[model samples]
Target: MHISDQEILAMMAIPQQREEAFKLLVDKFSQRLYWHLRKMVVIHEDADDLLQNTFVKIWNNLDKFRGDSSLFTWLYRIATNEALNHLNKKRTELLNSFDDLENVMSGRLDEDPLFSGDEIQKRLQKAILSLPDKQRLVFNMKYFDNLKYEEMADILNTSVGALKASYFHAVKKIEALIDNELF
Candidate 1:
């Protein structure tokens, strides 16, 4: 049985139904959010940890959600922030440059048994990893998740024009990288 976001929110507003509402939220969004985090983090374990942290924050701040945007957008914003923060923390802790971290993540992707992508997909992911964080986020959301620019704007709190420009640059860079490697 499919439940709508409004139904979930309505249930959440009632004290008696809050737990059930949360369960529904988790069921509805977990896999999608996990993949979103996994694409960003590149390691299954790290993505899982970040996913857990995202849920914890969601549970803590559920009441603070004012429904200014769709539930999906709000949830995505939380997950995206968590992933970005986790990456930033890792970068800070390693005392390495962003490129160094990207190289490390690329190595992890190669070694990751859980990564089931074929060679081309792996190459694409490496190209994606080469992007700056914001561009990576924009590319992942638009290319993989198929979110609209307006939704991405809401989730990332940036203008649609900025997102379009970022995606354009990301695609150009990826195309250059892929063309160089493939040909």
Candidate 2:
């Protein structure tokens, strides 16, 4: 069945239809969600885990969805939170320093078989890793995903102005880092 978000919501209300509707929802969004998480986490395994966690959260909490935002927005918000939380836990477990966090992520990116980008792309990824987690999130959403500031603000629960500032700073930092490495 060609299921829209509204149709899914309607199906979710009926007990028997809920599972089928949720399955369709997963089929529809799993790829987009996977790529978004992949960009944030870099490692395929970590991204897969986070994507599963995001879907599990969605399945468990689907009833609580109030339609305050688009279903896609809600899903992205959940996925973003999962990625950030996973990174935070990893950061705390590995090292007490942000510099260490950068090295860890960069190292993972290097070792990832899926990362087939050229040298400049790899360096840009490393530069992105150097940003604070929040700024990195903003940069990924804005630059890689090409999401608008207003949409990002909704996902990140920040003002558009704040997201813009974060994006601006992230761009500047990434540019400087890449330039320094080149010279």
**Highest lDDT among the candidates is held by which one?**
1
Question: Candidate 2, residues 1-183: lDDT per residue as tens digits?
Answer: 567899999999999999999899999999999989988888999999999999999999999999999999999999999999998898888775656777988998888889989989999999998899899999998898899988998999999999989999999998899888896
| lDDT score, candidate 2 | 0.91
Candidate 2 wrong stretches, greater than 4 Å = 96-99
* Candidate 1 structure, TM-score to reference: 0.96
Report lDDT (CA) for all predictions: 0.93, 0.91
lDDT, candidate 1, equals 0.93
Which residue ranges in model 1 land beyond 4 Å of their true spot? 96-99
RMSD of each: 1.5, 1.7
